[model samples]
Target: MSYLVFEQVTKVYGAVEVVAPFDLDVPEGELVAFLGPSGCGKTTLMRMVGGLEPPSSGQILLRGERLKKPDRRRGMVFQSYSAFPWLTVAQNVAYGMRYRRDLSAAEKEEQVQHFLALVGLTDFASEWPNRISGGMRQRVAIARTLAAGSEILLMDEPFGALDAQRREFLQLELRRIQQEEGKTVIFVTHDVEEAAFLADRVIVFTRRPARILAEVDVTARLGASRTLELREGTDFFGLRNELLHYVRSTASEEEGTA
Candidate 1:
């Protein structure tokens, strides 16, 4: 059975439907990227999975059980700087664990340290969020989410604000972390290359009333090694171009109809 399943899920606001009814199954430990143009309901679908927004119709199932509200099992990392300015890096990362009655103080600290190291933020553990760069803050956010023991991660363009160099670096780091930890991730991104480089499978969406246009398996083309060298390969460019074509074609279709 799939780890996460969206069955005939639809999202609407008033008379307008943003996400048309669609069905998708994401296997355990797979990193799936939702790629499309703006207002394509990628983020909206992610939010439903995260339980930040309820689906207007249909159900989102995790492990065959319907997900009604936000739970620690599914964590979210947003594009914005979500860390608290007043808290230190370690404190921010440990914040989510405070609610867990199952973990002792020592266990929480250990988990925090472990995840911080995974994101290469061990040295900055005592530093405040404002003291770190944008990329570092996002790292802290990811560490926090992981520390909460979330099996499914929903990231909404977490690296979209970073510069080219930092974005690329974080993309690699995120892939490494996901692989090592064996977490299922649903990432929303507008960047074609970002989707192609990071996802095991890329799910392309159409305009406003979003529906799956295609599912491109990156592993078949890029293989398991996600190094910087892979980005320079002809196959990578081919897949990237294919994703871009989907986005552009969808946009052209929308414009023609409008």
Candidate 2:
């Protein structure tokens, strides 16, 4: 059975339908990217999976059980830097663990140290969120989410605001962390290259009411490298172009219909 299943899920707002009946099965530990043009409902779909937005119809099942509300099992990192402004880096990373009754004070501190080190923020543990760069704040957000023992991550363009160099750096870091931790991830992005480089499978969506236009498997094409070298290769560009084509075609179709 799939770890996460969307059973005929749809989202409607008044007379406007954001998502059509959508069905998907995501296996455990797979990184799936939802790629589409703006207003395509990809972010809306992520919100439903995170349980922040209830589906207008149908159900989302996690491990064969209905996902009813926001819980620690699913962690979300939005495009904005969501770290607490007043908290130090360590404190921010430790924030999520405070909710867990399973760990003692010492254990939580250990977790904070471990995750801070994992994200290479150990040296800046005492610094405030405002003192760090945007990319570092996003790292804190990721560490905090992981410290909460979340089984799945819902990232909505988490690196979208950063400069190109920082964005690529975080992308590699995120991929490494996700792989090592073996967590299922649903990454929402409009960038074709970002989707092609990071996802095991890329699901392209049409304009609202959004539906799947194409599902591309990129794991095989990724080969042994997950670095800039891979992005520079011909196959990577080919896959990215294909995804772009699908997105453009969807936009063209929408324009014609309008």
Highest TM-score: give the candidate number. 1
Runs in model 1 deviating more than 4 A are 256-258
Error of 2 at 227 (Å): 1.9
Q: What TM-score goes with each of the models? A: 0.97, 0.97
lDDT of 2 by residue, 1-258 (tens): 668999999999999999999999999999999999888899999999999999999999999999989989999998999999988999999998979999999999999999998899999999999999999999999999999999999999999999999988988999999888999999999988889988899999988888999999899777524888888889898998899889889878867742
| Lowest lDDT 10-residue stretch of candidate 2 | 220-229
> How does model 2 score by TM-score?
0.97
Model 1 misses residue 228 by how many Å? 0.7
Q: How would you encode candidate 1's per-residue C-alpha lDDT over 96-126 as one tens digit per residue?
A: 7978999999998889889889999999999
lDDT of 1: 0.93
lDDT (C-alpha, whole model) for all candidates: 0.93, 0.92
